[model samples]
Target: MKPMQSPLQHTQGGTSSGHRAWSALIGPIGLAMAVGVAYFLGARLSLALLTKPDGVAVFWPAAGIASGTLIALGPRARLPVVLGVVAATIVANILGDRNFAAGVVFALCNAGEALLVAGLIQRTFGREFRLESLRSVVG
Candidate 1:
């Protein structure tokens, strides 16, 4: 004879059905802000690090690597983080130059780099770090 799982226990394995609607709206909304901030900060940090050198203008790509790795490995919010960051970078470029060409390049290259890194992480790590795993380990 097996014991029946309580409703709470059964629902705890994944996101709850009731919260699915809330997640639909809030998840992307929150990720956008986080990605924007991460991208901005990542780019700014790279720019500052490379400011002393001349003829080295790969700041956006380098920042993408850092930001992407952090987003993909540091959290499970890789896609949203990268998207938000790329969008913000494009917007910043357009604002600065009033042209979309450079922005497009930056967005595409950064996103590509991020995707590559994310794929590599997924392959290397076997699986993403999960909240339940952490909880079990901690408890």
Candidate 2:
């Protein structure tokens, strides 16, 4: 006689146990919002200094780093948060002054901030996406 198989065995595994929507959108959206707020605040604070050509040197990078680091700290959201920070920083720079030089500065600062924040999280909170090691046992 042939062995019986369950109907579910033929399917592509069971339904996902993790979040479907938050994993898709909330994290990235939150990061974008935070970056926007930071950028505007930075721009406003630097307005007086930005009156001179050299004063454009001050705000954008600081804003990008601060916002990016904060966003990366959310749970189960490392990937989206980091990407959103970069995207928002670039968008903010482009829309604020529409210049390549300023855009590059924002990019570098955002990248640095993401790296630093990710490293700290990995070291302190323990990595959530690591493979588990198998243990040996005697019967």
Candidate 3:
């Protein structure tokens, strides 16, 4: 004496093992893509802005991108995001012809800066924070 379930209902609410497996695979793949693209763009821009022999860029967009990614992905994905950033950093340095040791140090600094920025922004503005507001600009 039970009612039958609709296909839509089953697809939407059922705990199918297939759905779980897809999500598990897709999430990491998606995250890796996002990180790789962001890191590549940021590193390229930073290299373009390099104005001195010391290898420092006039403006490091990677820092901002890393921070923004961390914010968007929330805290659960920090390690992976940072790892992506570090990999990107090493790649950038190698392409720019810098030494391996220098690349590692620079990557560490960039990741640390991104982590600090993300933590501060999350703590100050909660999860609803946005940079489009004047308040966010001022704060």
Candidate 4:
């Protein structure tokens, strides 16, 4: 008699269960790293591009990075990515002499923007969607 294989054991393309588990664990870590790097780069660029008395940048690079990350990571990675963004935002704000309340608010806005972008992309194109052409742009 043949032995029954568990669902997890039947990994796609013969990948091992241990490998899949490691990848699952690493995905969030990579997201966190990406968020941190994006935040840092945004802060530097914002400081360099400061022209107004309010010190706001003409382009917030972190916003685009966060949105792109959320889109690429998919729905399953939302929580971790949001948490990472919040942490990065708060740290950046505090280091830049901003208050905790402001940091929290800004973090919330950043998170909300990422969620909105990700949800729109997912809803408009489904999970297997790709921004590959003019149709994707139009959509």
Which candidate number maximizes TM-score? 3
State each model's CA lDDT, in order: 0.59, 0.51, 0.77, 0.76
Q: Write the per-residue lDDT of candidate 1 for residues 1-139, one digit (tens) a residue.
A: 5464322223344567776556655665676676676676666555445544462444564455444445444545565656776786777666544368888787777767776665655555545534356542342
State every prediction's TM-score relative to the real structure: 0.58, 0.45, 0.77, 0.76
Clash pairs for candidate 4: none
List the RMSD of every prediction in angstroms: 8.5, 12.5, 6.5, 5.9
| Poorest stretch of ten by lDDT in candidate 1 | 4-13
Q: Which portions of model 3 miss their true places by more than 4 Å?
A: 1-13
Q: Sorted by lDDT, highest first, which candidate order results? A: 3, 4, 1, 2
lDDT of 1: 0.59
lDDT of 3 by residue, 26-86 (tens): 6655675678678868888889788877766888877878888788767766776787788
lDDT of 1 at 111: 68
Q: Backbone collision count in every prediction?
A: 0, 0, 0, 0
TM-score of 2: 0.45
Per-residue lDDT over 52-119 for candidate 4, one digit per residue giving the tens place of the 0 to 100 score: 68877677788877788778767767877788788888877877778999989988998899899889
Best by lDDT: 3
* Candidate 4 Cα RMSD (Å): 5.9
